[model samples]
Target: MGTGNADADAVLRILVVEDEALIALELECLLDDLGHVTVGVAGNATEAIAMGRSTAPDVALVDIHLVDGPTGIEVARALSADRRTTVVFMTANAKRIPADFAGAIGVIAKPYSERVVASTLDYVADRRAGRDGPACPDGFWPAPV
Candidate 1:
């Protein structure tokens, strides 16, 4: 959880799924900067599944398209099936995602500012803390229960 909060319980184990090395690195850095744990990263659906099984991430920042295939959409759904974990799509191809994607809480479009990511994640933390108000950020929809 990087160096932000000293309280270990506040940290979130996050799974990152992006094929591009640089983007993956940046995403990891960003999550770390926000004091979240990078449980693991995977470039494909198979590895993503494996990581999810092993890490049991509290949150997942998934890309819609991976090097292996455009399987991230399904990956997000599968990961979100575990009620404890929430999945958010962070991709350049948000337009391609179906509006009614059943298993994701929200989508954070590519080239998003760090502030946007932080705010969204802060909202997740609040929800995880069992305090909830609105579903998601202004532009996103919450995942179905």
Candidate 2:
């Protein structure tokens, strides 16, 4: 099984699918701090779908609500077609998620803390490392006050 460091290899290319510009930028910055590369940022499902096909990122962070017709769940399903890519949903709505997205790494609730985001990323990385069980890396903290 691959280790967390193995998952962090290859620049950890990622795609951010969000309609809100500020949130997108925030996520991009966070990914940057983690040493991950943001290959593409899309405002809606259609654009996200296109980017997914072209960029082929190692992971995709998608917001549930987008400008385009389909929700982020739709985009997640589309991007996840490539087994190499991990799909993570970002939204304030944590009550429920589509049944089709059962395979997603996890949901990152909005108004997200840096700790939440970091933990989510670490979890995804661990899963990619072939660890079936949940694993939360140390040193995560909520967004600064």
Candidate 3:
């Protein structure tokens, strides 16, 4: 729901930094369904940085493991250089993300569902709006009422 780069009410231009083709495709579809646009998909650190520069996405959904290697964290670090970009790590091994990595906004575990994705986005929106009360504990977003 929230990985793409979007303002509060605008369609987000998203940059998907996942190496898996199928997962990347599914993410694109889900973002589109949520009224976001997939600006590009990257499979490695190099590609991710390139896409970030060209697309200037509002947010990036990055996987910790990338095509080049375990460089997802590197990608996130690089993308965060842009003040307008928010980085969210998405990986099966969420434990890899550092507890105090300021470059990232948050993370969501892999094998997520449609509703989870939607809720995650909503949570990100809250974060951008400065209403994110606390760091989401384990990314558990309550079901929308």
Can you rank all candidates by TM-score, best first?
Answer: 1, 3, 2
Model 1 per-residue lDDT at 2:
26
State every prediction's TM-score relative to the real structure: 0.86, 0.80, 0.81
Clashing pairs in 1: none
- Who wins the TM-score comparison? 1
Model 3 alpha-carbon miss at residue 35, Å:
0.7
- Tens-digit lDDT string for candidate 2 (1-145): 1222334343578899888898889888877777678999999888898999998988898788789644777788888888878887777764556655645666777777776666667666666666777655543321212
- Model 2: worst 10 consecutive residues (lDDT sum): 1-10
Q: What's the CA error at residue 27 for candidate 2, in Å?
A: 1.2
Model 2 pairs in collision: none
Better structure of 2 and 3 per lDDT? 3
**Reference-based lDDT, each prediction:** 0.80, 0.73, 0.77
Candidate 2 structure lDDT: 0.73
